[model samples]
Target chain A: MEAKNSAKERMVQSALELFHQRGIRGASVDEILKRSRAGKGQFSHYFKNKDGLVLAVVDYLEAIIRSGQVDSNYSFSSWDDFEGWFGRYIGFQKEVDCELSCPLGTIGNDLTNDQDHLRRAVKSFFDWSTAQLARFFAERKAAGELVESADPDALADLCMVVMEGGMLMSKITRSTALFERAADQVLSYIRSLR
Target chain B: MEAKNSAKERMVQSALELFHQRGIRGASVDEILKRSRAGKGQFSHYFKNKDGLVLAVVDYLEAIIRSGQVDSNYSFSSWDDFEGWFGRYIGFQKEVDCELSCPLGTIGNDLTNDQDHLRRAVKSFFDWSTAQLARFFAERKAAGELVESADPDALADLCMVVMEGGMLMSKITRSTALFERAADQVLSYIRSLR
Candidate 1:
C-alpha cells in the first residue's frame, strides 16, 4: 500500500509540473511517464489515461492551495490579512518571471468546453476555493474586522474573478503590471468596505 | 485581384471560426480547408503554415475590433457609453451560452509561452486595444466629465484586466454571473471617480 501511494503521488507531481510548463495538450503521457520514472503499466494502474491524470493534476493543485503551501505565513483574520495574502500571491508570480499562470486556469481554459468531466472537476475546485474564501470573510465580519456592507460570498467571487483574469492577462503580456493594477483595485474596493 | 482577396478572406474567416470553436490545437489545416472550400494549395499560397494562419487570425480579430463591427451601434463619449458597452458585451456572452472566450485571449494564451512571434502579435493587439480605451477615458476626463483624480491610462488598464479576468472566470464556471459582477465593480469604481 505504501509503495502504491508513493507511485501515485509521483505521477501526479510529474503531471502537474509538465502541465504548467507546457499546456495540457502540449504535455504528453509519455513525457509525464518518463519524468516520473514510472513504468507504462504503473501510469495505467494509477490513472487510466492522460485525461485521468489531468483530473488528478487539478486535485493536486487544489491541495496546494488548501495546504497553504503558497501563502504559508498569512492568516485571514482581517482585511490586512487578505492584503498580505495577495501580496505574497502576486510576489510569487514575479518570482517565477510571470511565465506560468494559475495551473487550474491554464488547464481549465483548455478543457472547459470539450471535457465535461474535467470541467466539472475545475468547477468544483473553484466552488470549493470560493467557499473557503467566503467563510474567511464571514468570520472576519463576525469578528467586526470587516464592514457590515460587505457580502462575503460576493467578495469571494469577485476576488476569484480578478485573480484569475489578472493572471491570464499577466501571462499574455509577460508582465505583472496588469495583475498588480487589478489586485490594487480589488484591494482598494475591500478597503472601502472596511 | 478581387478573387484572390476573397479566397484569402475565406481562409482567415474559416480559421477564426474553427479556432474559436475548437481551440488552436483542435483545429487542423485540412479542417480549415474543408470549411473554407478553398483549394489545398490556397492555404499554403496565402499562409506558409498553420502558425502563419494563426497569426493571420489574430490580425482578423483585431480588424473586427478596429472596424467596430462588434460594437458598431455603441459610442464611447461618457460613463454611460462605457456601461452600454459592458452590458452589450456580457449580454453577448449569455447569447452564446458563454462557451467562447475572447478570441484573441484564447489564441494568445495557447501560444504565448512557446511561440515568440505569436506572443508579440497578441501583445500588439492588446496594446492597441488598451490604447484605444485609454483615449476614450482621456476624452471623458478632458471634457470634465470624469474626475480629475482619475488616471485615464491606469483606468484603461484596469478595465482591460477586469474584463479579461472576468471573461476567464465566466468561461471556467460556464456562467456569466462572475463576469457581470467584476464588470459592475469596475464600473462602480469608474463612477466613484466621477
Candidate 2:
C-alpha cells in the first residue's frame, strides 16, 4: 500500500513538473511515466489516465498554495503583511528568472473549454484566494482605512488579476519588469485609497 | 503567384485558429496542414517547419493587432479613448464566451523555454504596446493631468499586466468577473494618479 501510494505521488509530481515546463496537452502520458520511472501498470492502477493524473496534480497544487490547511494565510491584517505576501512573488520571479509561472496558473491557462472538471478545480483556487483578499479589504474598510465607496470584492479580484497577469507577462518576457511594476502600483494604489 | 501566396495565408489562418483552440504544440503541423487543405510540399515551400509557420502566424496576429500600420493607435489621447480601448476586450470576451485568449497571448503562453525566436516576437508586441501606453501617460503628465511622481512607464506596464492577467483569469474561470473587476480597478487606479 505504501509503495502504491508513493507511485501515485511520483506520477503526480512528474505530471505537475511536466505540465509546468510544457503544457498539459503538450506533455504526454508516456513522457510523465518515463520521467517518474513508474511502470505502465502502476500508472494505470494509480492514475488511470492523463486526466486523472492532472486532477491529482491540481489537488497537490492546491495543498501547497493553501499550505495544507483549510483556511490559510490568505487574509492580511496589516500593510506590511500585505507587502510581505505580495513581495514574495516578485522575489520568486527573480529567483526563477521568470522562467516559470505559478504551477497552478500554468495548468489553469493550459486548460481547454472542454475540460470542465479541471476548470472548476482551477477556478476554486482563484475564487478562494480572491475571497481571502476580500476579507482583508473588508477588515480595512471596517476599521475606516478604506473609503466608504470601495468595493472589497472588486479590489480583491483586481489584485488577483494584476498578480496573475504580471506573472504571465513576466514568464513570457523572461523579465520581471511587468510583474514588479504591477506589484508596486497595486500596493500603492490600495494604500492611496486608505 | 497569388495562388501560392493564398495557400500560405490559408495555412497561417488555420494555424492561428488551431493555436487559439488548442495550444502551439497542441496543434500539430499535420493538423494545420489538414485544416488549411494545403499540400505538404507547399507547406515546406512556404514555412520550413512548425517554428517557421508560428512566426508567420505571429506576423499575422501583429498585423491585426496593430492594424497593418507602422505606428498604430496604441496611444489613448483621452480617458474616453482609453475606456473605449479597454472596453473592447470585455466585449470580445463576451463575444467569444471566454473560450479563447488573444491568439498571440495563447501562443505566447504555450511556448517552451527553448523557443527564443517566438518569445522575442511575442515580447515585441507587448513592448510596443506598453511604450505607446507610456506615451499616453507622458502626454497626460505634460498636460498637467497626472501627478509629478507618476511613472508613465510603470503605470503603462501595469495596464498591460492587468489587461493580460484579467483576460487569463477570465478565460480560465469562464466568467468575466476577474477581468471586469481588474478592468474597473486599473482604470480607477490610473485615474487616481491623475
Candidate 3:
C-alpha cells in the first residue's frame, strides 16, 4: 500500500513538472513515464490514459492551491502581509528562474476547447482562488479595516483576473518586472482601503 | 492589386478565427488553407510556412486593435466612457465566440519554449497593448478627470492582466458571465476612483 501511494505521488509530481514545462497536449505519456522513472506497465496500471493522468494532475494542483496559499494562515491578515505575501510569491517565481510558468494560467488557457473534465478542473481552481480572496476581504471587513461597501467577492475576482493576466504576460515576455509592477499596484490598492 | 489585397485580407481573417478556435500548433496548414480557401501554392507564395502565417495574423491583430477601437475618435472624456470603452474592448470576445482566448495570450502561454522570433512577436504585441492603455490613461489624466497620484502605466498594466485572466476563467467555465462580472468589478473600481 505504501509503495502504491509512493508511486502515485511520484506520478503526480512528474505530471505537474512536465505540464508546467510543456503544455497539457504537448507533454506526452512517455515523458511523464520517463520523468517518474516508471515503466509503461506501471504507468498504465495507474492511469487509464493521458486524460486520466491529466485528471490526476489537475486534482493535485487544485489540492495544493486550495489547501493553503490564500487560507487564513498566509493571506490578507494585514496590509503588510497581503502585499508582502504576494510580492514574495511573484519574487519567488523570478528567483526560481522565470521559465516556471503559472501552471493554472497556462493550463486554463489551453484547456478551453478541451474535455469537460479538464475544463471543470481549471474552473474549480479559479473558483477556489476567488473564494479564498473573498474570505480575505471579509476578514478585513470584520476587523474594521475595510469599508462595508468594499465588496470582497468582487474585489477578489478582479484581483484574480489581474494576477492571472500579469502572470501570463510575465511568462510570455520572460520578464518578472511587469508582474512585480502589477502586483505592487494591487498591493497598493489593497493598502488604500485601510 | 486590389483583388490580391482582398484575398490576403480574407486569408488573415480566416486564420485568426481558426487559430483562436483551434490553437496555432493544434491547427494545421491544411486546415488554414481549407478555411481561407486559398490554394497550396498561393499560401506558400504569401507565407514561408505556418510560422510565417502566424506572424501575418499577429500583425493583422495588432493593427486591428490599434486602429478604430483605440485612437482619438472615441472619447474617454468621462469615467463612464473610460469604463464603458475598456469594458466593451475586453468583453467583445463573447459576441464573436472567441471569449476565452486572446490571440496573443493563447500564443504566449503555448509558446513559452519557442525560439526568439516567436517570443519577440508575442512581446511586441503586449508592448503595444501596454503602450496603448498607458496612452488612454494619460489622456484621462490630462483632462484632470483622473486622480493625480494614479499611475497610468501601472493601471494599464493591471487592466491588461485582469482582462487576460478574466478571459481564461470565462473560457474554462464555458460561461460568458465571468467576463461580465469581472468587468463590472473593474468598472466599479474605476468609478470609485472618481
Model number with the top lDDT: 2
Per residue, candidate 1 scores C-alpha lDDT tens digits across A29-103 of: 888888888889988887878889998899878778777776633247666677776577577678878777777
Candidate with more favorable, higher DockQ: 1 or 2: 2
Q: For model 1, report DockQ.
A: 0.62
Error of 1 at A9 (Å): 2.2
> Would you estimate the TM-scores of all the predictions?
0.92, 0.94, 0.87
Better of 1 and 3 by TM-score: 1
- Candidate 3 chain A lowest-lDDT run of ten: A69-78
| CA deviation > 4 Å runs, candidate 2 | A1-5, A68-75, B1-5, B68-75
lDDT of 1 at A164: 78
Over the stretch B20-50, how does candidate 2's per-residue lDDT look in tens digits? 8787877888888899899899899998788
Top TM-score prediction, candidate number: 2
The reply for model 3, stretches above 4 Å from the true place, is A4-7, A69-76, A112-114, B2-11, B69-78, B96-99, B176-178
- What is each predicted model's overall lDDT from 0 to 1? 0.78, 0.82, 0.71
CAPRI grade of model 2: medium
Model 1 CA deviation exceeding 4 Å by range: A72-75, A112-114, A143-148, B72-75
Candidate 1, residue B166: the lDDT equals 68
Task: Write down the DockQ of candidate 3.
Answer: 0.58
Q: Model 3 misses residue A3 by how many Å? A: 2.3
